[model samples]
Target: MQLTFDADVEEFRRKFVEFLDEHMPAPGDVTERSKSSAHVPDWARRWQRLMFEHGWLLPGNPPEFGGRNATVLQQYVHLEELSKRRIYHSFNPQGLGIIAASILSFGTDEQKQRWAVPILRAEITAALGMSEPGAGSDLAGLRTRAVRAGAEYVVDGQKVWTSGAHDADVLLTFVRTDPTAPKHRGISVLLIPTDTPGVTRRPFPSVCSPDDLDFNEVYFEGARVPVANRIGPENGGWQVANGSLGHERTLLWLSFADRLEDLLGDFRPRTELDRDAYARLVMDSYALRMLGSGALAAAARGEQDTAALSILKVLGSEASQAASERALDAVGIEGLTHPAVTAPPPPLNIEHFSASWFERYLRSFAGTIAGGTSEIQRNIIAQRVLGLPRS
Candidate 1:
């Protein structure tokens, strides 16, 4: 279901739409090419510079720290507009959004100056190295150790599923600083340069397809980082990690609108076997969009309901699955058969959609698994939101 906006919001939408239409990189161009393994594409960096020059890359930070200091409503409006156009600047994500935000909230002034400007200007890119092979959802179990020396911390551990690490200039990594302390208490966050000695990156094949590029494994062996690089207090990295995840959950869920539009395309199966199933799909998609906007509104108000995020994570994944399944059933033989030809020229060509549907289906399957699994979300909602007793 579509929604009506207030006049002011409608005007914001108009400008946003116009900006994206004018500035967004064309598909199949150099800007659209997928980089090697979790690497930042050059076109994406150019796009980030464009946003920086336009003063839209990161709007919440102070003007001194490379942000527009836009209001929360404006931020929501901007994000919504960009998501609608499937436009996201890749290079500035770390410096402007996560890393810079984290630092501005906690880091020393010198640290911010040294790091924040370059990130905002698209000069440096950073990847998050939080999930390890043995520890992903259960972050407390992370075995990566950061042993402190006189003035540096020597990090030695493996981080799995480190997205965009290969092309990143730095890594905001979480490690255990004090094993003796309780699980979550002893952890620390470090901003380690990827070029630091003993840091290695290896590509991991995608579960869905080799053509899909993202995901990587990182090994840190005596990866030395200055003590000054720590974002928050030692053993208090959980808060930083949680904060990053909170932001990520919101951002990831916002992408569902694009998924919905992709499902609504012409090649979508026309045959409706069950009226109830079709109705359920339509209703669920509507609900997802409404809840997404509601979440955005709340976030703009400086309030984020994790329960709402959890519900959206689970429901949106299910909705994506349902839409894909229904579309496949609708397309029948065509769905089963792989595309044999390249897409034709502009507006008419959507072969990318066809090629990506199955991959998206499999990737969305992990949506429930990534931020927090469905089981984890259910427990969170039950215990935190519903105030249920732990079993």
Candidate 2:
């Protein structure tokens, strides 16, 4: 069966297209150098601010939160259109997509105004401080400690693979608040300013490229975060962490299908094997979109299927990696010759798709690892969906 949106959703798409036509930045407005750098460019910040002012930055949010309170399907369409064009609403993905969402979900009214609004409006950027050296996939095992000290929580630990921390204003840090409690129960989230007296960030290059210095190792040496900055109750950070991750995975799973679609559109198959592979990739992209649509439908009905989300995460990530591999193969050795040391620009950059096939191929591996690893997703699917016992 053909997948399609109803008339109302189509109308929403039409208006959104009009908005884009009027406000979308001209090529060269956001330079390739800026897109590749860790710093958020002035142009990007302005673009995000414009979208927020127009109620298109996040269409599902209320007007005060940079949205028009659009329907869930309309919101999906908004994201799909932007993805099809390779446009990102915010340069800070974790800020807008995950941390801000978590703050809005669990933060008090005052906290929402203090953090979420500025994030949605692009006045400030945030980084997720979830993963550590020992707790990449299994967040429950994170060892970062935050001991309560009067009106402040003294943070002392390290966070690895923290994207954009070097340039971010704040880090939504997860720390062990109660060591005596169970692993998952003792966690808490602290919005620690990057410039705090004891906070230090060291930028690190990813395997994708040496110039890709987006990831950082952040150290907190007796960093004193105000108790008022704590999100959710003390030792109640597990729930906040789950909400944050859920927001991240949900956005990522949908974006993967869009990225695959873009890849398929740009790919030119040469041989019979290439042709077959291209066809399969196209089918996989379609399947992912269908699955995403089903998930959206369920959400609209006030139903949530965590298993379906896991399956989407696995399929979408693997399909993206496979698509990138096939593209590299189609181009043969020449694909391998693309300069690998330079940072890969954002997808909106014209050169991003053309000159960086090798970079894209390397970066595709991150999709599988981020949000949750493929192995972790499979275990979740087996236990939660199939009702299988833990291995």
Candidate 3:
């Protein structure tokens, strides 16, 4: 019932703030470079190396694996602080958030040695290839096939929306390996090297923007991956994928909650958000924070409520939409003209927030669709939370 940071977490925040103040790039540095620079891998690597050296890259990773072995509370503090300052290593999410943690839990020690440290150091980049053009939200319907052949599996299929596939070194992909089993039961996950002979990647225009945040269409024609690369047993990948999604714990998707608080806190009288509007923002923000905290508390104690995750997704998505509307109203027409609205928001650039208001609005709209659609979330609440009949 009592949701608050302990003293240790507060101390960690103070130290983290100091580190950022001293070593973090100046806001303008990102803006200037992004305006003229090409997609330079070295730039991202250099920045990631700096954070890694400071043991700040993945605070939750074990110390031996380049993490601080931070407590859950500490991790929450770090993320919240980073959100407040608008500081985060945007490139590491697919790797650190999903892949590395997965390896830590499911991979052999040898596999961990091969992948974990380099990933934490940001020396390697990875992508998630779970969504196919035909199989998105309905993951079980995936058609990408990986058939066992001697010590390797021959893969053949196409994946769409493979973010960063063009440059990523590897992909954590789910492929169908058994047609006889039921849909969810027939899939398996693999760590595939993109440089394999039969692999081809073609860039696609981002649904959001063309400048950055690009997704790709990746083709696999008899791509051979060692059997050692499989994450879980053949036809048993559903549990692995579901476990990973559950690990996200809803908080990851609700990052908008913190942003909403920031936007609402910065609101002024001239921006056209009425006093009532501001008050509603305050109330909604507080309510979300409490609900999210309770969900986390339940999760940490091993009594996670599926309905809470569904509720958080729905409320959080709606909250983000509401907050975006208010932020645009606060900045008046200026927000509409911001750079993210005009083009891709500059990576790591905090100064060019001009188009970010609108860009964020566009991006956050996906919050409803990404993890699960709002309609799907409602169905989950109806059946799982409300105990309703399917018919």
Report lDDT per candidate. 0.71, 0.85, 0.73
Against the correct fold, how does model 2 do in TM-score?
0.93
List, residue by residue over 1-391, the lDDT tens digit for candidate 1.
3355567666765765776678876665542454542345667667767766666676555666545676666666777766544455553354456765666666788877777667766678777888888887888999999999989999999999886787778888899999999998999999888889999988767876576445788999988899999988999898988787665676566666556555654333444564556667778878887888788778766896889888888888777777766666655565545541235323212124446445545656665676677888898889888999999
lDDT tens digits, residue span 266-308, model 2: 6789999999999999899989978887888888777878889
Point to the candidate with the largest lDDT.
2
Quick one: RMSD of model 1? 3.6
State the local distance difference test value for candidate 3.
0.73
Clashes of each: 0, 0, 4
Return the lDDT, model 3, position 190: 92
Model 2, stretches more than 4 Å misplaced?
32-38, 339-351
User: What CA RMSD would candidate 3 show?
Assistant: 3.7
Runs in model 3 deviating more than 4 A are: 1-3, 26-43, 265-278, 300-302, 326-352, 356-358
Give the candidates in order of TM-score, highest first: 2, 1, 3
Q: What digit string (tens of lDDT, one per residue) describes model 3 on residues 1-391?
A: 5657779888988888898788876545554332211132455557767877777776777667755877767777777777766665545566767777777777788878787667767777777788888988889999999999999999999998876778778888899999889898999999998898899988767545557645788999999999999886778788878776765544664585866665676555463446666777778888888888887677666676888888888887788777777666666676655543344444564324544666666766777776677887899899997899988
